[model samples]
Target: MTVRDLSALFLDSTDRPLPRAARELASAGVPVFPVAPRDKVPLIRHGRGFRDATTNLAQVDTWWRRFPQANIGVPTGAASGLVVVDVDVHGTNGYDALNRADRAGLIAGWEFLVRSPTGGLHLYYPAEPGAEQRSWQAGNAGIDFRGDGGYIVAPPSLRVIDGETVPYRITELATEPARPLDAGRLRGFLDPPRPPRRLPTQMRGQGRTGPMKLANWLGGESTDRNRKLFWASCVLAEEGVPYRDALEAMLTVEQRDFGSREIARTVASGYKRIHGDPRLAGKNSASGAGTARAVVDAAPEDRLASARGL
Candidate 1:
């Protein structure tokens, strides 16, 4: 089988701009998952300033061992994959519409895909019902779908061909729909989930309480301003908002002395920027005032002072 056949096996008929070789492969009846060129996949640099790279399962575990002080509630290493989009029917130029559709479909139909340890998500779709297109986009950023029949997004190292692993650029092709593999068999290929490993006693020094333990510090006497700020920060953190923005918004909320309108604005901004909306943070009202006050009263004095600009 040629590369085009390989593309048909892996990609749908929606992705476009197939590379010449990929089209040739597709024409020759080769199955392929046309991935983008090497320089395209984003690379995160390693070293002192950068978050350590965990390209695979082993590296992920090693990073966890070294950063025992870090929280493990979330995956430490990032993984990559592809998202295919049907470009022929939707019109290749209408990428935004295609993206929204793909995102919705993935979220609604395939929640399991979201649980991957890798951060990269691949979108796959058919490339023309008949003719060949060159390339397609997975979504935002620089991710591209390439090949004559269809495209694929994979790590810079891995490549896919007619059931054979070889160094070939991902591109499009034409072929029958891919057969659904047994879910159990696929799971067997994945890294097994392990229990939370404990760090060494030496690594668990004075400052090394787990994330849960440190959260207990939120208890005790705090000002109304501080209390609101704390709750807002907790809400954002729980929702997976980035650290720096969450911190800034929390600070802004506190600095405004917890005025309802000002607090509302700060919360709204955070919701918009982080979680997509302010109301999703839940309604804050006079009903919670007494509870808020009580929480402030129970906070540590030093924490309260810090909250109140002391």
Candidate 2:
């Protein structure tokens, strides 16, 4: 029901087995359900995954009796008054991201830290009452936030990792008073929104080829969009187009799965590779198209790499 109660449960259940730990948690008003042995999938067939969680002791007993090795699962968010920030280490470097977020104060106020079987971390925090913090993933950062509509495998539960059974163990508890996490703020920090791009100019007098034509070509790309955009921006940079003008033109491209931030970043990378800086461009190259052609001809390898979206 409160942080204090769960804290006691974590401490006392460190040596207890899974079935007893599940009972003690339910007795403390923390609803729980049975997950498969050494796995996260719920054992309950024909039932909603986390929605079937209940504080009923009889049901908990029956389920565990049927599958003695079942792991303990607790629903996160308001259902159990808890949420978790899962820092993974398998593919992406989540600890690096977590450390950066911690330094920024975006991932502070965690009540407890559980070391996952795969050497990842589970930072537990109290969920803010009367609010819904839905689950989300920052896969690139190797971090996942589990809130409403999500369930976590509780401690003392075993997981088969790399052909070995490993336990989810509590490694630390907060010394000072713990506070609820701001899920929305953390999400925004992880994936910040890019500002609106400057609109393309309607004038066609400056460059030999108009920005609108490039925009039309970019908009029609159905496959390998990022590579195409980067190569096109590199070509434009070679032509002495100003970085601002080139960005404006690319902003006019309407394509799915390509956000403004990504488009802007790719274009900037291309421009930087060419001009050695993103802010400066070849505004004087209007009549210097031959100069760009000469540069490309001299460095065929670089142009080839750019084409492969390097």
Candidate 3:
């Protein structure tokens, strides 16, 4: 049968996957952008951040033509008015957590879902204006959210999880994302009841040292910069550093060699890995935890599929 035919599986490298996916998402009024093809790295991040996203048919056409191999990106929060519940399939944790959430009526309002190449799931919801949402490790295992300041890789892009390349496809397709889950209820169900750990001193918007500190800690090696920055950003996220604060901090060192685009990409990836097993923290570090995660998280995305992979 044809690629568009019934039961066609995997959208990897289908003819014009980027343009095709972009056209569909844009037609539904979803703001869209291009990402590094075969990789989830963002292509345009300046000026408006993901806020620069657009549904302009011509802009969409121009982007795909310019970066034919680029992946499709859907800015998670106000850009597209979306909030996604990311249920990871690295293990059964996401599944179990989702089940628990389901029983508690947490996921009852979900309107659209996508099955990720890695076997994870993406539950999409519309966003509410001025929503106080933030991207974080959900209270549940292997569960996370793409809310304000967050984004999700859209379909027809190649996702290389571990060494296996697959497509981000709809399990049951929809023309557009559905109405959002009840934000208040979602928070109540997903957030910890106790007071969260204090924000890092620099994250309070008080210190310029935060950036230098992370840069210093990460060292100055281009080869290791991406990986180090990836894990360091994760630690910053785990420590509850504000996104802008963390971005500034990471950017200080990122100036040496890595591009802002790389920083942006690693930060997002690091944010996602923060939810994994707590025990795996120091799998490769002599110093333990963060160091180890840095090495692994920095490695090629495919290498991340190993038992010690981030």
RMSD of each: 23.3, 15.7, 15.3
Better of 1 and 3 by TM-score: 3
- Model 2 compared with the native: what TM-score? 0.63
Which candidate leads in TM-score?
2
Q: How many clashes show up in model 2?
A: 0
Residue 202's C-alpha lDDT in candidate 2? 44
* Predicted candidate 3 versus true structure: per-residue lDDT over 60-82, tens digit per residue: 88988998878888777666766
In candidate 2, position 309 carries an lDDT of 19
Query: What ranges in model 1 sit over 4 Å off?
Result: 1-99, 103-118, 136-143, 147-310
| Displacement of the residue 123 alpha carbon in candidate 2, Å | 0.6
Against the reference, the lDDT scores of all candidates come to 0.29, 0.72, 0.59
- Candidate with top lDDT is 2
TM-score attained by model 1: 0.19
Q: Candidate 2 lDDT, tens digit per residue, 1-310?
A: 7765686787788779788999999999999999999998998878987789999999989888888899999999989999999878789967777655654555656676677788777888888877667777878888899998898998889999889998887666665456677675565456443322322354234456555567777787687566567667766777788888988989988554566665776677667657656253432223322322322232323422332210
| Sort order, lDDT high to low | 2, 3, 1
User: For residues 1-310, could you state the per-residue lDDT of candidate 1 as single tens digits?
Assistant: 3223333332332232233233333334332222223222222224421122223444434443444222111111111122232222222332333233323222111111110112123323322222223233433222333333222332122333345443312221112233211111111112112212543234355453332332233222254333233344445555566555554444332322233443444344334433454443333222222322331233223312332210
Which candidate would rank higher by TM-score, 1 or 2?
2
User: What are the TM-scores, per candidate, against the unseen true structure?
Assistant: 0.19, 0.63, 0.52
Q: Which residues of candidate 2, in runs, are more than 4 Å off?
A: 194-310
